[model samples]
Target: MMAQGKAIAVRRERVDESVSGQRIDNYLLRICKGVPKSHVYRILRSGEVRVNGGRVGPTYRLAEGDEVRIPPVRLAEPVASGPTPAGKPLPVIYEDDALIVVDKPSGKAVHGGSGVSYGVIEQLRSQRPEARMLELAHRIDRETSGLLIIAKRRPALTALHDMMREGRVQKRYLTLVAGRWPNPLQHIKEPLFKYLTPEGERRVRVSSDGKASHSIVRLVRRWARFSLLEVELMTGRTHQIRVHLAHVGFPLCGDDKYGDFALNKALEAEGLKRMFLHAAQLGFVHPLSGERIALQSELPDELRVFLDHLDRTEPQKHG
Candidate 1:
């Protein structure tokens, strides 16, 4: 445990196989309990943190046997506000020695930070203290509900990352958008640039200088004023699905960012309280077994109820 209220001397750690391939920023965040994320990045930017006697970027992946030099920083003492919330067990979709997949609910973050005290990963770690290793294979937005993958071992995590990078993993989402989709199927290829607002809130936009992004959208159902779409991401970028859909003039229902504000307000009043996006399906090969793995999560009751309401009141144009 880290001692609070005083700066400790710098320490050096040698990477082992268990921790190999983890990003430097994430490694620091895990080890440096109570340290603010901004401070961690500050130290990284200032060259205070080093790997093998040289400065490394935050995204640098650790290799086995690499020596990491962690600088000293003071951590604030814990305040006894109340008892820490117990880690509630999430709905498990699948689990094995290699990984665990869970049905993550909408509005819960995958990991804790930036004003969130605990999230799905932290909750899972708290629940399974006996487990040797647990790490996120990928991430979905806090407001996006659906299947999430957590690796039980480092090798599995590394393998899963490679598979995703190679586009061997297929991810599909179900979302309700504002407007009638013209085509039965359409491919949206747009570049997305991420930037902070004047107040430092992260936001992504379609820009010429942004990284390439692609989404294949298939219309599932259409109402007089809304359309349900199945979106398959060809490239995983931040807010890829939301931004791409919104950029094409069909903002996702209840999406606060990059959404129709007036429609969102009306949606909240009509019982569509959260973003209408669900990670409905995932298909990939098992990292350890080399067997195929396919998983699906049905839309949550709330989202389904909203759709039912739409069907009851709105005229259906397509199905």
Candidate 2:
């Protein structure tokens, strides 16, 4: 147990297999009970926290057998705030010995951090503490609700990563955007660069010196002011769908980061509170078995309700 209000002496710990691949800052945050987030970053930036006698960035991934030096600081009083909370569990889409797929709802982060105490991964871990290994296979934005894959074993996780890199995994999303989609079938190839805003918020933009991204968008339907689209991602990049659509002049409805501000305000007045993006389907071969598998999740009730409202109020528009 962490001693509250007592200054801890500096200690060194060797990374083991269990902690390999986790970010250093996250590991510190978990162990340093009651320490403020700013302090963690401050220690990191000051080089007081060293890995193998050298300063490492916050995002540095830990490796097995790496020596981590932790400077002692006073621990905060034990607070119940950070413990995993009980709530409605995410709906399970598919489960096997190697993996588990769940339908993650919007507004829930995939993992805890950045002011979120607990998220889908943490909650799942809490719910199944007996399980030896469980990790995220991939991530969907917090506002995007749909099928999320969780690997139950390290081998399974590795297999999924290889599959994603090889483009064997197929993912599809449904979104409603601000303008009519011009093409029945459209392909967007853009380069995206990620950067932090002045306020420390992460953002992405199209840049010449950026990573290559590709998205295939098919028009699903059209309304008076918005068009529903089915987006198939060819290259997975940060904010690929949102950024691509915004660059193409069809920003996603209710997208706070890369959306139209005035239109978003109008949309809120019309009762659409969340981003209109859903990971509707995922297809990949089984990691353990060679069989092909496809999982799907229907639109959440709120999105469905908003779509119904649009259908009732806005007549279908012909391009």
Candidate 3:
């Protein structure tokens, strides 16, 4: 039976030969790392799980060539405090009759509600009471700071949304991640998925069966044990860069969800606070002019200080 809004579904996957010696529950827990072990066992008991197209016991051994099917059920989670208004003012990057561009600060949401009293858009309205209508042209993570385009009118919002669906807009980010990259520039064509945990937190990872996510990464500079990276997203998914980078073994600095906590602490000690991801550039067509516009935001002060430390500790590569 499916939930009211859901289309009843069963996800089937084959057990890899390497996992031949594991317990069924262990195998399930390993593949779905963010889920609870008890939940995996519960599914086993519920008769919602099958192996080799047959029902299996909790302690059943997972053999090399078994097909596993899992029934679908929506996991419940409390909504995150949606975007809320901020007392701090915003820096406008670009503004026209159709839309207003902003270099949004971190710790703010693009949209309002869920649990938040006010988001960036709402706060913008509070400050600029003259504005008539507002809508988000695109969205970035709440923890991420930089280039956000807001439509000031409904028609403009429609036009921007249409362009985004057609993949006409481009975004670029600046970030710092663990370890040094062998290549100065490279592209990662990895697939990604967001695995929801029982605690209502989120984990991102690379998966064989996942949404296609592509990023072009460039090693801008390196410190004693870290690297500054420039990332241009070819396809967008939740936490795409953070997930792909972590899967490649170099999580972003200060990204608690998809980062190394120990390293984050060390960076924090150095006063390299906040997640290293920053939306640096945005390019899109004008809604009315039919002309293209590219906008950029300078690296924030914190990132600059971190860069300073890198320059002092590591050999600089001059272009």
Residue range with the least summed lDDT across 10 consecutive positions in model 1: 79-88
Give TM-scores for every candidate, taking all chains together and pairing residue i with residue i: 0.84, 0.79, 0.69
Residue 105, candidate 2: how far off, in angstroms?
Answer: 0.7
Task: Give the Cα error of residue 102 in candidate 2, in Å.
Answer: 0.8
Which parts of model 2 have CA positions greater than 4 angstroms off?
1-77, 80-83
Most lDDT-accurate candidate: 1
**Per-residue error at 48 for model 2, in Å?**
18
- Candidate 3 TM-score to native: 0.69
Higher-ranked by TM-score: 1 or 3: 1
TM-score winner between 2 and 3, please give it: 2
Candidate 3: the clashing residue pairs are 83-119, 84-118, 84-119, 85-118, 85-119
Q: Which ten residues in a row have the lowest lDDT in candidate 2?
A: 77-86
- Per-residue lDDT tens digits of candidate 2, residues 1-319? 8644668899899987656777899889877868889999999999999999999999999888999999987776665667657578779999988899999999999998888878899999889989766789999898989989999876678788889887789999999999878899999999999999999988999999889889999999999889999999888888999999999899999999999989999989998999999999999889879889988889899999999999999989986
lDDT of 1: 0.92
